[model samples]
Target: MKFATALLLIISYIAVASAHMAMLWPTPRGGFGTKQYNGRIHAFIGYKDNVWKVRFPCGGYAPGPITKMKAGQTINVRFYASGMRASDIKKQPVLTKSTKQFHQARHGGGMCEFSLSYDGGKTFHLIGRYTNTCPDAYFKWPVKIPSNVPSCTHDKCLFVWSWTANILPQYYMNCADIRLEGSKDGKLPSQSIQIVDFKNRKMNVKELGDGIKHRASTGPTKKEISGNLSGNIPKALKKA
Candidate 1:
């Protein structure tokens, strides 16, 4: 009886630990959950020194299949902020549930950003961002690719999704291997690709200890940069 009870306790702990958001579309570095490993769905959800989570890029996951995309295309990014159901992992694009219950796992709809990396996840360029009420009950969000973004091959390109919770200091990220189909190795000006820390709340780009500045190279004025709310986060998240 004691052995059976201990097994039950272990399973319960894993379920609670793994109850978090997951990237659904563009199919993150690792695919959705499995019967034996449901925690794989939340593999990229990071908190402080969680190693595979906030501390490492792509949650320390290796690259998966490459998705080919165009420079100026609108891609639908999907996420499951709500708790997962058995049916959620059975299909592609992840079917949305109509249930009315609010899952606190949504983290009160936090800020989300879409970025692209050309240097094997060393640096990222912000392409689009959404603040405040993001990733609500609605699971799908559309991200428009900027026209001037450069083309990249499979190994060098990564599409990254980052979120900072409004109710919790927790940070989450997922990366998808992608290749941009276009011509000419045109690079955007330094002002356009701001080098910011989408990593974890504990560390910034400079803290990586690589001596890389944590801001844009050319240093655009504060008025020019958009959707950056680094220091001023919601009070609830701070206290949490």
Candidate 2:
């Protein structure tokens, strides 16, 4: 019995380590109820693996609740990095502290995009993009809706969150269902995001780094907050 229990423990740890980030707010389809572990309020909606993420759009989730949002408004979207709720994690392991706990892996913070798809997941229009220091400690992001985005009350609107890891050849995506209230202008974005291809294309590490360097500016300082990080630690990211 003891040997069997040990095997179970090993399996559990491996499951956690393999899984990555997922959306927490606005409620994606299937309503954050993945087959794996649940987060603070709901289970994470990330794909089981990198291949699973790229193989399907919106993590292959069905439509859930519809968030009625207005155009040109900035809303804070929440995420669970590494399938563990960021709120329940520490920057480092507990050997350095008295408390015993797990830490979320940042993966060196990569480029993230918040795109809108009026026609399901067919095509996505780039609404907001962030580089360098995305998915910070809290894993919550501020995304602004473009005033030119047309309302989607008549049909369904898919709000997608895509991230390309800078250090690893990993890509994560989560999509939410939203019903947009028309803006004063009531126009659509002139161009769609060309770079975000839904094909089974995974960007190599060199490509990810090049994209970051190309768009590099006086962006947020890179914070080394991986669970495996040792030595000096930076300031805790302010809560969202």
Candidate 3:
């Protein structure tokens, strides 16, 4: 009887933990729960030292397989902010409410960027860019896979989603495992940097607003597909 009581108390405490956002489409929390879509949020892409998360390639490694899609493919990517159901993102205040206070000081609106990796999780080129305003529930983003993509038989190319927080100085990065079976228009970029931003630098929220600086090297939009993101591919990777 005592053990049962302790267990209940522990569960209650866990239920009050700080709430955060998660990816719903490539369903991570696909397991089972009232607040869980399928399973726990990005079980593989865990939090970083500062409570944020890893960048592209998600700490330079592949997490787990959710699903696979073809290249040059147009798909609607979905997101689940907090709680188990899609509607929970709208009622985020409920999950964020703790005993002492309500964590309603911020909104989930921010910048979402998608990128595709050709050579495993080593490097990635931008795919699509999404911007949202506060007091909005914009979750789905349309994306087109690069028609000219390489195939990965044993290994997996990465589908990366990076969210730059508008509410805080931190950001979250997650990776999806996918195997592409197709040809390439040309070679993938070989010489790109790890992104020009607050990475490895001191905490500067004001300068890192939105956390992303759209560069000429990326094609984060639909129309930009015809044109490549990085200038030189083989060269870029060589340097990388």
Among these predictions, the greatest TM-score belongs to 1
Better of 2 and 3 by TM-score: 2
Report the C-alpha displacement of residue 235, candidate 1, in angstroms: 19
lDDT of 3: 0.43
Local accuracy of candidate 3 as per-residue lDDT tens digits, 1-240: 653553354344335433344454443222112222222232223334333333334533334654577765765665543323334433432323234322221233455556766566567776665543211123245566656666655555667666555545545455666766657554443333334235563342311122222111111234322223331111111110
Candidates in order, TM-scores: namely 0.64, 0.62, 0.55
What are the per-residue Cα lDDT tens digits for candidate 1 across 1-240?
Answer: 653553354345345555566676777776453122234445334443342344357766677777889876777777654343334333423333334332426555556667788877778777666554454424345665566667887586888887665545556777888888654766642422222344433533211111111110111123212223231212211221
lDDT of 2 by residue, 7-91 (tens): 3543464464454555657666643443322221112223344333333566565566778888766666765444333224333
Candidate 1 segments whose C-alpha is farther than 4 A from its true place: 1-16, 33-54, 86-104, 189-240
Q: lDDT of each model, Cα atoms only?
A: 0.53, 0.52, 0.43
Clashing pairs in 2: none
Residue 176 lDDT in model 2? 81
Error of 1 at 111 (Å): 0.7
lDDT for model 2, on a 0 to 1 scale? 0.52
TM-score of 3: 0.55
Question: Model 2, which residues run further than 4 Å from truth?
Answer: 1-17, 31-54, 83-102, 137-139, 194-240
